[model samples]
Target: MSDKALDEEHEKYIKEHSALFANYAKAEFMIKHNYISKQDRLDMAEKQEIALNRVEKQEKRRERLMKQIIPRFVLYFAIMTLIYLFFRWLSMYT
Candidate 1:
């Protein structure tokens, strides 16, 4: 194979196999270098299922308030204010 054809084949192989080998090289490098400490890993593991459940509950509660209650409140306020202004405008004209 010519050098250009070999380069194209290597590129094709890399593109085809990227998903199968995703982050493998980076993991290998990290294992050799050990960037994070064992203590930090233990700290991450301390946040177990209970903590995750609490966080998920809070997220759902916040989502409900944001998606339902707050928007309803704002819509009611805007609609009532507009209706009141329309009545006041009519009363003034009459």
Candidate 2:
């Protein structure tokens, strides 16, 4: 296609999808920040729901990681303590 024709087509396409592009930008911004600022108002109900869900999902993932980390740390400490006690007792007998 010629440059002028291509330009016109591009402009038309953008005009048709302007709302879609705006929504995508908003969603991208929200995902990066993980929360909307007080100054930024979410006009659409769908956008609000998506933000709430993302925040909740992050919290759940954090809780899961904490649960896993605490148990592993306690198990490691317990094993090390047992090994130290065993060596001390063996040295005393010998």
Candidate 3:
């Protein structure tokens, strides 16, 4: 390829392949993806990524809240029952 003659021969070979290239079929060319540019694809990717992050953040917050907080009624009912039993035992025995 360094010599002029070799470069010319490779160029001729590449030209022959280009000459044989076929045009796209009408059905294939009409597909939506074929019409989307790189910037459109990137924009869609960014929107989807933001949505995914939002969902993930909400899920993690929900899980953390579930772990940290107890239902108030259950805790209060148990504590009141124990106090009532303890007082009843004191009244009966003392």
CA lDDT of every candidate: 0.64, 0.71, 0.61
lDDT measured at residue 82 in model 2 versus the true structure, 0 to 100: 100
Model 3 residue 47 CA deviation (Å) reads: 1.0
Q: Check candidate 2 and list the clashing pairs.
A: none
State the displacement of the C-alpha of residue 21, model 3, in Å, after optimal TM-score superposition. 38
Task: Please give the lDDT score at residue 60 for candidate 3.
Answer: 86
TM-score of each: 0.39, 0.53, 0.51
Model 3: residue 76 alpha-carbon error in angstroms: 3.4
In TM-score terms, candidate 1 sits at 0.39
Residue-by-residue lDDT tens digits, candidate 1, 39-71? 754554464345556556755865775688677
Q: lDDT of model 1 at residue 68?
A: 85
Count clashing pairs, candidate 2.
Answer: 0
Give stretches of model 2 more than 4 Å off: 1-43
Per-residue lDDT over 1-94 for candidate 3, one digit per residue giving the tens place of the 0 to 100 score: 1369657855865664453332123323434557756676676557656755765675687577656555655788899999999999999988
Worst 10-residue stretch by lDDT in candidate 2? 37-46
**Candidate 1, residue 13: lDDT:** 53
Q: Count the backbone clashes (under 3 Å) in each candidate.
A: 0, 0, 0
